[model samples]
Target: MARLFTGVVIYSFFVFLIMTPLKAKPSDKSKTKQNKYGIALIIGNKNYKDGVPPVDYAHNDAAAFKRYVIDILKFRERNIIYLRDATKANLDSALGTHNNVEGEVQSFVREGKSDVIIYYSGHGVPGVKSKRGLLLPTDATSNNAELVGYPIDQLYKNLSKIGAKSVTVFLEACFSGGSEGGMLIKNASPVFTRIEAPKSNLGITILSATSKAQLASWDNNAKHGMFTNYLLQGLYGAADQGEEGNKDGKVSLLEIKEWLNEEMTYNVKRQHKRRQIATVIGEENLILASVSPGRQFKPIQAFEKKKTVARAQRGAYQTPTISPSARASLNIHESYKSYGILPIKLKGKRCVPCENILIASLEGLPDAKILRGANARKADVVVSSFLSRLNVTQEANDAYASAKVMSGMFGAVLGKNIVDHIDRSTPPSFNIFDVELMLTAKDKNLGVSETARGIYFDRKDARQPKQSNTVKGINSVFRQAAERLAVRLMGGTPPPIKSAAQIRKQWEDKDQNAQNGNWSEDNND
Candidate 1:
């Protein structure tokens, strides 16, 4: 008995020793480096001037990133500069004047011994004249961004003067002069803003939410910018654990970008029915953060669960109500697979262009198919619309006209908008259109029907009195109405329809190229 017990104890001890990891317990993968010589400038600008739409959840985004910087990245709270709804003066005070790059940030740097991080969640506009990408400060206007806006190149130049060992920049704004659901600049003749992409210098690395011509999205459920939400998720260890990552614990700059590329592409496509690709410049092996409890990352599963909820929200699309007359047609799925979009009736008149725009809006439903101008009997579903109201009012843009106002009578008397052509201090005005419509969807095979009412507005710059934006505005209304009806009948809400300017640009391109250009959506990217 004594020999048996001693042999069992010796064998168990040997097995335990062999099974243990040789590297280190409480493994280094869960450990992050202490960045003592790093300084961060985090700014979230949401409430801009009245004309500009607020960047919803920008403050939340900034707050979350600031927390990660201090807690996860091991940055000291004292080394961080946090700003919300920052103004031009605030920018100048923190990063120094454009003329001389010397501010609180400059004072913190240790002359080639520090790493600098800059993150901005706000609006970015391009110079109407220079076409330079400019950060739209709270006190700035997109139409006159060149003067009041902070230049991106100037920002890089100022940071370069600090002489940090390396600088990393994260921009949660797009410079396309288009807001999440509207236009930022009111331009005459539906001109393309053509804002250039935000760029960085050799020593500076930049990760922007959207490329030029793309609009950044808001994740209303997360209460954060879609880009910023995933950004924090990556910093929270998901990036270190992704398949592209080595799972060695440290999350590198390259690893996070790779993770963002895959996740952002997939989520934006599924959620918004649009393409929003994060633009990354410069590939460095610099470690951004580290995972904890080494290789025990659970964020992947959590986020996947959230995605599944989104998928469920976009539930199996079926007719909301069915008639008793067609008993056999009441079955779902097979009965309403395609909808024939009839020409929308505008104030009791047929408008083919309005129908075309409405048809374009439903083009994104992945499960259901759209049949343009198909007969009601031929299609499984019949879609139609009636425009109830189309109203327009001309008004001055407060952001631009507040500087100095000239009577529209001057242009009215001169037979043209002389103020616009003369480049006078008296700014040009805009046209605001309010459109209301009732959209109807009839599941023909199911003998069911549903109706949705939608009201949308479009603002167009009236710089040239000769050019009328009525057609574009009406088209925009029909499109928005279609989006609303699509959600009511098809379960998932689509992205905001294109602005009047974008629709006009398409028409102009079609005319100029004689339909041979084959304009593609990716061109805007």
Candidate 2:
């Protein structure tokens, strides 16, 4: 699948309403409807300690998310644990200590009876010593993070052991040192930190605010985090809107990821003018929310380790994996009928071969016609790809500072020329200009769109690969990126590129099957 950056929702009296659901009377302690089965731990930390940056409108974001939880997802209000500007003690009580997981937020799960939702909108800072990501509490200063701040990894661990049927976490805080909310760390500057997909337990999914090289942005006009607002909007029926969505009235995990990357990314690009994509972990194709009121999630057999797997299989292009029977409850998007490949550009220079390489890469993209020449303008969707130079020297140097923070003597070692002096360092040397691929697909005629981007050093380790800073290396990156983007643009998972010999073998097998009269239904030959 294409690596995407994006997620969000919004509601108001005058806002556009998609579909109104008939609410059921609440039997629980609170006045919320008895629809969704879950407990939610919502923390919107806005006011930070003195000198720390406040997450502007974070309290508003949490409040809005709560509204959706009740009004849309229909979770009873009594089951929710809401905290505004939560303190270190509050977070510890709610999420448990790093050493032991006894917090009500995780322990509140009723085994098979309740799913879990965790939403946090605050400042996340990296540990000065360990360099791990931490959610700074209102009372916790960025410098003393390891002592008072909440470890994001531990948060995952706590949530994973909840024994709930599923755990869905929505985080509006950016862990890479900055946010529209405020500067999280005291003297720390923002550096690109690739947030890894947590090793979540079965049925756990996490949708967070920003990609590796982005800061969490806010909608000043909306007085909400842009991610939080858009996510609310999506859950409120924008995700399941018309053809972009399945229109099934239920928003699935896949639908949410897709919708956010498309709608939120475009909106951010249009509004913030900087990249901020939502990153998701886990592939459980579960329904996240619904337009229909009081709809319940049907019981699926308990999540067994032996039963779950993720595959980018669609139509006839099934990946080489387990079996055909494994792919049930498939959330398939619409197959593109026609597409146009606009000229591929690198630093504003046209690269004809790059476009040709991309066109050739799309050979396995099923059920799509490539619009040719002038007719390309008439394509159902037009694809545009651009590659640009990215300088990471400053970011690299900041990482060295983080290295210094990790250990005092070690910090002294990674001094002014630390970016160059470190041997096998976590922060890579800034010898070469990194590349960023911005891939956009727009169906302007149909008011549909998607944006996906990948950076050369966009990884947790930030290790330099054998691919060097040369034309060949750039082309290599472009080829793979182009394929991934094209597949995603066409609404399919990127399949392994078929070799020329593999293609020949396929034809030879077809010929043999025809001669022997051994045609199979699946072959469709």
Give the 10-residue window scoring lowest on summed lDDT in candidate 1.
304-313
lDDT of 1 by residue, 1-525 (tens): 443344334333433443566875574445666778889999988877857778876766776677567657777656888777899899998888878888888888877878889999998876667777778888776466568888887887788778888788898988777778577676722222333333545477778888757788887667678888887778677887878888787778888888888887688788889988888776668777777553222221122111111010222233333233332442322233666887666556778766655554443332244576546446777887777777777876432432122224244543334444323422356666766677888876556776766565655566544235666656655655665565545343333455446654764564334223232322210
For candidate 1, the lDDT comes to 0.64
**Residues 130-152 of candidate 2: C-alpha lDDT, one tens digit per residue:** 76777888987666766887887
Candidate 1: Cα lDDT at 145: 59
Candidate 1: deviation at residue 468, Å? 73
Q: Per-residue error at 465 for model 2, in Å? A: 76
The best candidate in terms of TM-score = 1
TM-score of 2: 0.49
- Name the regions of candidate 2 deviating beyond 4 angstroms: 1-37, 200-202, 293-525
Candidate 2 Cα RMSD after full superposition onto the native fold (Å) = 30.1
Candidate achieving the largest lDDT: 1
